[model samples]
Target chain A: MLHTLPELVNQRTTLVRRGRFLCVDFRLSVGDVDYDITVNHGRLVGFTSDGGLLRSWRFRIAAPAQTWLAFWQPVPAPGYHDIFALNKSRLARLEGDLYPFMSNLRYFKEVIAIPRDFNFTTEQDLVA
Target chain B: MSASLEPIVGRYLRTTWQQRPVRIYFEEAGNGIPLVCLHTAGCDTSQFRHLMTDPAVTDRFRVIAFDLPWHGKSPPPVGWQDEDYALSTDAYTEIIRTFCRDLELVKPVVMGCSMGGRIVLNLAAHHANEFAALIGLEAADHQTPWYDTEWLNRPDVHGGEVCAGLISGLVAPQSPDEARWETLWQYLQSGPGVFKGDLHFYRADSDYRDRTALIDTAVCPLYLMTGEYDFSCTVEDTTRTGAAIDGAEVVIMGELGHFPMSENPVKFRQYILPVLDEIEKKSAPKS
Candidate 1:
């Protein structure tokens, strides 16, 4: 259905790189709701919405290519939520650091070694 | 009279031209000139089994139905590419050309249903002289944006592939139909991955509308038909499509959806007989 994320509210953002990983900080507000997201590669590692810890996901840098961050959780867990809430000023600062991190992550992956086989595989066969 | 209700299966013709496997089935009695019937996507010539059995139509002319490449009993081409599976009108035109040449049959009245309809329209547009007349049932009209920007955006339980499987279930009859539908579904899922490839092609290809317009301008007379409730190709859509072709005869089967021929055999025969009669009269020898 509507798989794409909604547009970001605040345009100002930043990104920071550490070793083989990059952190993307961005602020997005929809209606009365706002969220501060710190994304690693394509996965959301740390998230705060409305000045509270929304949720954390198990994220690992893929091998070989190491260009992708794989996010996964146990099968029985509830599904991921779309929106989050966060305070205004912290969101602004986080947004500045997050954008550059995402941009740099994309750049490094493009410039350096490519990532391979980043899909999640369950040990238990769901189909069977 | 031709054999009645008895399953008549025989070896007709087989060829491996253009690296594509081809099989042809020839019936005893068909009126007027030879009519080549092309089935829709995913279905074999068996879908036309009822039409083949009807004496009124078969006695008047020779009806030739063949499996399109990689469908039904026809084997896929060696190392077939996904691009080659769902053909453009140009590719279909070539197939008809090759079929006619190999079978040594003159340009006959070409009638097709669904995907078959699309192919015949392409032939009529580009090579009108090769066919006497053309009939299309629920032919695909719009291209890329129509499906991608619109239909593809709609939410479904298992995407378009599963939706197609559901439609097959609806068309199939209950008693013996269950088995047939199951077989078709299995075939669709496992066969050549053509279904997915074709879906993508329909979404990406931009020339479908242009081809419909081209067919409309061709010299040969064109006939368009669709069921009232046909969700795949609606009557309104068919009406708009017919408007593109000058003097194109349009028929809307009331209370009928897609696959009118299969859904209502009696009514399908009633409508088709007159066309066959007219073609027979035209093709008759003059002294």
Candidate 2:
């Protein structure tokens, strides 16, 4: 049971209910660093850097640190505004099974776009 | 009476195009020279919901938006069960022409976005003498499609969710949450395989590159405005298209994307009102 997913998913009761059917885990890479992203029933449980090699993920969405920085901005630029746009512009690379990615596309989009409040003055801080 | 009526009125019109008769559902508001609106692929008359209600426009222009068959509120033409709905350029052109003639709109201004945008170029190329002007929003001669549309129709995924999800990115992040989600809601309401079916026109059937040189803006003014954030029809695409047409007016709107009118009507109005005003002046009786 997802006791805390509501709070995690914008505290929206509706999303919390809908999240029940969603279960996806993936790896997000910014530069050389890899962050294991887990979405258990629609809740973005966590995205922590350094997933052990033994851990498995369905897909990997990788981008340059600068691309991640541009995307995380409260208001992103034209080409960097969307994951698909990034992939289209070759600013980001999405690999592995796209089935899961397309299956819960909205969930993946919203979860990734939850907007990080982190204040990073440089690509180094973002990668850190 | 707590039930106040909106100024808009809904109605049905019958028109036959390409030997195929279809019942079209259209909504209208305001009163003046008819301004026929064409919505983006997979969307319907609802995209013009805000445009119809805006008094600034309604006072001078009669805004009318119609749903294509197999789209919102409009059912497919009879005998559709055996056919897959594919909107060809010839069919789309004839539909608008027949619709305008049936409605008795005298030289109505035709404005459209996306696939609708592509067709206006065809309209100008072949039928400029019949209309007052042409406005193409998020238009281009051509742009390679960014994503495969197969994901939108597959049984493995929820069709509505996938369609709305893919389209959500096309709306600019600067758009208000209310307007943005409402735009997605419209996509969410699109029928099964309908969005993909419409892509038959947008992704495959419509390419105006070779045809742009044939459009003569002298017969009817052509205005091409594209939102800055529309990756699907990039600013470069609109500008290149504009350059190909000698006298076309080109504009790059800021902080908006593919579905400019639906996703950010307020901002779209700021850019569009001026064009409408210009059109009114162009059509005014010379004294």
Candidate 3:
């Protein structure tokens, strides 16, 4: 799911329109791994595993890999149903500046749940 | 253009809150016992639109839904520029009590959701004699607050949209797309900060745990119903609330979340109709 996050997001042009004015970077931590992601005008432009200094992001959304696994399921249940739900239940943690995140909330939520919408795992599809 | 008229009527009532002149906007339909609805925090009375328009409900019960001051069509108390709005327990109860008196309603069975839900406990505990029955939807004596209320009110945020976005997940995933968005549209149109102002009572001011044991069900039977999908007021919250109050009845609504009536009126009807029927029966004079 993490590997395909960019593809899954870029494919949904209609969903990205809602946050077309937003341009920011954010961090996603699944287990011990981290991905520094950049979104430009609502499209996921790039992301990398580069660590150390000079990295900046509007916010960081971190949860255990298992938590993300449950969240990415085709049909998550209850607390796993939404990011805010996960945050409320304390299964996931959100830190750093929340301005961009809150201002573009619906877009952010829709973008992150792309995996749920596509349920992608195919390498051929990922190559696209 | 094609348009259909609903039997529902909207009107404003002349009233007062703590010696200040006030006006309340409400919509009503049907003809029997008054079913005054209290909407969730920040949002207004539209949450009960389906119930008010349904013949099954209105044919036998007069349904009334009102916007609390500073919500929907109801404006805040005067002296406009200087005050920050906050709802208190006494103020909330008084608003309902006065609305009833102004309408000349006798023993109206009150049903409220979310903030409306929590306040029912206050009504049950201190003013039970004024109501024939109390129904609390997505209700609990208390639930822990999960977010900073300021986010819903601050200047940098689009209060209405952010507010709607935050709560959209609270609606059941099974609800129809139409009903779900309709519920969100209401939040998108909410007055700035009104949702947070109402929270003054929900998360802080209206904690009913200390007084739950004081409610006498024999006076006004209390009913607790919560959606299975509501994390804010989980089933456990309502269950624990029901247990604390003797004779309180609890029901868990399936495939529904916090905003039951508004988000999925079709499914909510299945759960609420029986309860409404029981209330109708209870109010019927003995033969």
Candidate 4:
């Protein structure tokens, strides 16, 4: 269900602009795929579905497919609401550099919430 | 719970332990034993808004919730911004003490969540005679190492949104959308850097690991409760904190979050009512 995240990220301009002052790299691991994203001066310069560049990013925020589904809900419940809560409860893992992730925390938070705007009828819509 | 009983709102004017002029916002309802409720860091008196109106609580005891300085309706102390508002253990304890003293609340039962939860331990340790009992909701001896405050204090960062996102994540997934959003709205409305300032005390200054031994339950009973979904202060954390304090009763709330009382009032009341009943029974004189 998380396959369309890259396309969604590219379509959201305001989300990108929110991180304008942030210049760093990060990764998002959903289910089995890893999405490597790079932002320079708050602009998303690169986003790829390839798992090979996993270690190149500063940090990776990873959660299970089910967890991401709940998080991307229009209004998430407790465990899926925030990335930090996920980490605190041991539901999600944040690895590698945490500086960029924390410094530009709001930008990344809003960026991740972009999926709430999408309409999905089934789990396959996110995966396919 | 009743829709009819509303709290009488008032301002508590008192000098902090530091002797700063502070006006604390408070709401109280019902009569009997005083239950002084404290909200989590970055939150306000509204956390106990429902409890204040609940007859099950008010019929047996007087419930009160107050906003700390730099939070909710309470403005920050004088020279707050230039010096940056920081809540130390002494300052936190003193404010609670001063508020109770000024209100002439004799031996009130104190309960708090998160930062407020942690502070109650200090209140028990240092001010045993001041309260009838202590309840720490989501209380723990220390914050998990996963929490980091570095970026939270950054001038360039929009901390209010980030703080809201961080806190809103700890609410139960089964909670009503209205309840969840209402919780989030409070975080969103918090002052700039206020959440982070509170975190400085919550994540850093409020560690009770070395001090829990000071709490003597014989003088005042202590109870600790944590939500199943509270990742920050998990069941394990609260359990360990309970073990540290002698004779402290620990309860793990299922399908709840950090902000139990505010997140789901009806569900939270189920857990709280029993504890309040026990306290009232103990206070009753003679068989």
Clashes of each: 27, 0, 0, 6
Off by over 4 Å in 1: A1-128, B1-7, B10-32, B80-86, B143-164, B169-192, B199-206, B211-218
Rank all candidate structures by their TM-score, best first, as comma-separated numbers. Answer: 3, 2, 4, 1
A23-107: candidate 1 lDDT, tens digit per residue = 4545433223344555554344443445445543222121111101111211111111000001111221122322242223323
iRMSD, per candidate, in listed order: 18.3, 0.7, 1.0, 3.4
> Pairs clashing in candidate 3?
none
Q: Write the per-residue lDDT of candidate 3 for residues B76-119, one digit (tens) a residue.
A: 88885577788899899999999999999999999999999999
lDDT of 2: 0.86
Chain B TM, every candidate = 0.76, 0.97, 0.98, 0.94
Residue A115 of candidate 1: its Cα lDDT? 14
Poorly placed runs, candidate 2 (over 4 Å)? A1-16, A44-48, A51-54, B1-3
Q: Point out where model 3 deviates above 4 Å.
A: A50-54, A120-128
- Model 2 CAPRI quality: medium
Tens digit of per-residue lDDT, candidate 2, span B89-154: 877888888889999999999999998888999998989999999999999878879788888787
Model 4, position A70, has a per-residue lDDT of: 75
- Residue A77 deviation, candidate 3, in Å? 1.0
Alpha-carbon shift of residue B91 in model 2 (angstroms) = 1.3
What docking tier does model 1 reach? incorrect
- Lowest summed-lDDT stretch of 10 residues in model 4 chain B? B5-14
Model 1: residue B273 alpha-carbon error in angstroms: 1.9
Candidate with more favorable, higher DockQ: 3 or 4: 3
Score candidate 4 by lDDT: 0.80
* Candidate with better DockQ, 1 vs 4: 4
The sequence of per-residue lDDT tens digits that candidate 4 reaches over residues B215-274 is: 999999999999988888878899998998889999999888999998898899999999
Candidate 1 residue-wise lDDT, B1-287, digit = tens: 68765443434567655556655444333544677787665555665666777878776667777765666666666677544455554455667677777777786888888667766666766778877788887665652121222221123222333334334322312214444454345334435444444444334442456766666434677778876545455566678878877777787765444565665566667677776676676567886
